[model samples]
Target: MGRWTGWVRWGALGAAVVVLVVFLVAQRQSIDVSYGRSPSSSGTVEEGSAGELSDATVPSVDEMTAMVAADPVVRLPGSIAHWDEGLVRNAIGDADVRILVAPPGLDKDERGRVRDVDNAQLRVLGTEVTGSIYQAAADDLPSWRAQFATGDVTSLLVTLIAGIRDQDTPEDVDLFRWRPPTEAETAAIATDLRATGVHIADGATLTDIPKSAGPAFPDGGALYAAFPQQTFGEPVPEYGPTLAALFPGKPIVVIYGSWIEYHGPNAADFTDVVGASFYGQAADRISTYDYPQANVLHAYLNRVTDVRYAGLFERPLPYLPLDPLRVALPALPWLFAGCVVVFLALSARSLLGPRRGVRSTGPPARLAGLTALAIEMSGLTDEKSDPALTRGITKLRAAGDALEQNLPDGHVGKLLDDAEAELDDTAWTLGRNDYRPFTYLRGRLA
Candidate 1:
């Protein structure tokens, strides 16, 4: 009985261990951390092919803004500072937009500029230029300043970029005399931009800027060629058509090295128009202008443009809160170890603890008697005159009789009676010098 009880206990423990192992293996499989890394900071720009502008009617800035705001994903360039709190609110409206910020490399003075922002529907990831913003969305990992709301980070990136650019440049250049990036430089910049996850239609420079109400700039200058109109801040209708053709269906970002007034009448036609100028003027305009910095003409242009082109890239996935299972995973091994220790302790206690005396019962006594009878019957010799054989037979008969009497008066009693009868017959056969019956009875008893 004790041996059977031990088997049952061990069987249950083994089953539990198997279940724990299976669960642990499943948990390990479910854990995935295969996020892609940022592209290397190599590659030079070399000009390639150019395409003709399509006559597709460009959406107005308001229309483009609405469209971008309605999209599931919107990718914007520049830091959080370029975005206005109210504009972000209006753009995102009721829907949740996960705003990821990958600022340029920071200097000591620019570090605090990327501080956490406040917005409930938005999650801000502080400056991580090498980190893939798309990966952050795809993996659903927590952001750097995940606690801050979207509004809290408003203009933070813009301000930081502006300040950093200002610090880097000792003097400002004349916008008219500024030398445009060469074809090779444009190609290299395009390559760098592509690494940041923005899709560049092709590595080509604008061959021509169609007719518009602006002065004609030198042709073959990638961005400058698109803006054939006078360098003075004015809407160049040709700019839109030229850009539309050069980079069809993609959001156009007009990046300028320094602050320049690029906003014009058809400015909204582009996805986003950004330059160091937009960020530099954001702070001063905040007090001069009643609206948020993003709502301002140039800032609005930048915002609307970003929204319009947001579709070209993957929509950033919302930031997922810290998982309870993930939090517990680190401690799971310790927990399992503790469980094993407890199990071992209990097993040891069971093995070493005081044992209770087993009371002798009728069934066990009868079983023992049966075993003794079988042994005595096997020892009987094939000699009828042998006194020792007679004594053994007598002992077997006594044991069988005692077992039969102790057994209950049911099927058990019947089976015992039959066995006793068989034993007696075997004893009689042995006495008559017939050993076959004795051997058969001994086999049956075994």
Candidate 2:
């Protein structure tokens, strides 16, 4: 039974360990995301790897006023903003927008923060349900904005963001260049993010968006007209693939970044592009364009050959939120092994039982019964008894002798016989101690 108990404990622990391992392995991708943020500030913002984006700027938002142009939907990230919270909220609530909470690290830097803020607002055109693709330029966002703008997006809105870095690195061609993304370019970006060990939404992928400042996605419309009162944060980094998956056919409205504030003192015609679609105080607040970061460098590269251009950066640092074991699967066997050891260590008490000394006396049941019998014999023998009795007593004892053979394992007969002999010798008188050893004798024999 003891050996059986040990095996049971070990088996239980082993099973638990295996179960934990399987659960963790299944969540590997989620775990990878928690580690996305880089501690120090030093990164690059290069040209994107997809479509040429610099050449396309057709009927900029400003130029298309009063025009009801409809065609097969274009791809774009979906988000909208408004100056007044009440207005933006009421409007987008019905139009197409489910605001998502910002991750902590995002709200910190206003510059980088704005891209996310503006991008979130784009949900009006409905990036939420339609998949918003996140594109970055270089390691930043110039590429996403630059190239995305080149593509026609009458239906989607893009979230452009960048993690923090020390230098813009503009002086070196290695730092920032204008380009578009090829099929290979897009695949490479997606692959790298995957290598980091993170799981993404079913249809989403990470593009590039560099870190930067306020109004990152500002439409020329009045603040209340487009963006809500909430401060801007980083936008999604992987929206292109997501959008394509969500609405296979739709126009994509590109509301990307321009360092120029759409509503600021020194704004550009592009601001009107942001404003054109984002009119109305309630549900129609469009998107904004304000840039401090860069867009997907790979997408930016692709934009070089695109018909139009729009680039921005806005993803928060450290993208996904999963535990370590769930993310890094290769390390699983060792971790589960450790857990098995811990489970075994805690089970020793139950496996060994009370005899182990640290606990109460859980001695064998048979041995305990014998000890009780010995105590009873010692007490009975202490009672006074006259051995120098008449012939009648002696004869009576002899008459019952044959019946004594049937006594049990720890019978008192042997002790009683010894005590009788001692008593017979003592006769007239004697202390109880004289017969005590006699009882001990019988006990030993038994």
Candidate 3:
């Protein structure tokens, strides 16, 4: 019985452990989010392809603010900042705005793409940039900021050379005069000019580039060009379509170069306009004036353009505590773990019996028989007794004591049989002269 009880206890404990382990394993944190895409999306701005815009209905800034405010996942260790739509509109006139919320510790790759696209949370509210050049511009803003911040180049010219249209070329062009180009500058210029399909005339100076390039600059700003400090291995693919859109013709030269022999006027106005139009003034800031979030939204849109439709997506239930106990939400997991341990302890106790004492050995029947025999032997003795019988009774009492103290089953049975035979003999001896045993027998004989 004791052995069986022990097995039950150990089995219950093992089962409880298994249950806890399975619960922990199954409860590993995970989330699922699905986004909408445009029909022409390729997840990136491919070469020679127009950009695709997502048709997903992104919530407004106010709506998103409320949603994010309510979410416990992003409510970690910081105060939530609210963005006013009217404030943004006042800053950047009727432009698109986007916001990206990603898991903490994840960052973008060198190509200006989210490292984990599937898990990225995106929201957009405004007109989408459908042109590939515009999309590329948005994507490259981050890279451009990094390059400029690191002092890779002093100045760059993003020239848009379109066929002279309704707007005529300016007569007094604030052209940055040029001197003899260094070997490096000349080589960089030649390589960069190929992208715009422009070739410099032999023995021609940089001042004459406007005429030589066969295209007129819009409103005729500065008719100067500088080779770009090539940061990436290849120019971003979006630049082609961007130039194509601004300039209806080819030979639209965009170049980057160091401040080589500063002898000419600073074309800051021309360069600043181009930079701001493509990359915002403050490229790093999340405010509407620069709106880096818009770029993020555009990037996400391109990736998901292939999604036929966007709709409500089911998310895993968040582990948020009740509002009253919001302060304890962070400790909720630990609390659950503690509860599981407590439950296991209780279950084990119930299965193994509440008391912690030794289990029964199941020898009650044998012990009871020995006790009854001892009582009967005592009863056989009285005040009227023979010395021999009394001596015999004393011997039986001594044997009974031996039986009570750890006697083997075979030995106990033999002792018991001997005691029974003796008791019968004693009864016969005591009752021999008594008429009670032979009353009917004596009457029949008469």
Best by lDDT: 1
Top-down TM-score ranking = 1, 3, 2
Candidates sorted by lDDT, descending order? Answer: 1, 3, 2
Q: Model 2, 1-446: lDDT tens per residue? A: 12334565677687767867586658645443222332222234332222212221222232222121221112222232212244334333344343332111111132133233332322222111122443222222332232223221211222221111222322211112223335654454345333542112222222323221112312212110111111233232333333233323322122232211122321234334433222211111111221221332222212221211222122223334676754656566666667577666647544432221111222222223323333443344322332222231343244244235544433433333333333322321234442333343344434
Candidate number with greatest TM-score: 1
How much lDDT does candidate 1 score? 0.34
RMSD, each candidate, Å? 21.8, 23.2, 25.9
In model 3, residue pairs whose N, Cα or C atoms come closer than 3 Å (at least 3 residues apart or on different chains), thus clashing, are 37-304, 37-305, 38-305, 43-303, 227-256, 227-257, 228-255, 228-256, 229-256
List per-prediction Cα lDDT, in the order shown: 0.34, 0.30, 0.32
Write model 3 residue lDDT over 48-155, tens digit each, in one string: 232112222233445445555555122212111122334323333333322333211111221133212222222111211111122211234343432322221111
321 in model 1: Cα distance from truth in Å? Answer: 20
Q: lDDT tens digits, residues 30-57, model 1?
A: 5433222211122322211111111222
Counted clashes in each candidate structure: 18, 153, 9
Off by over 4 Å in 3: 1-4, 35-136, 139-366, 369-446
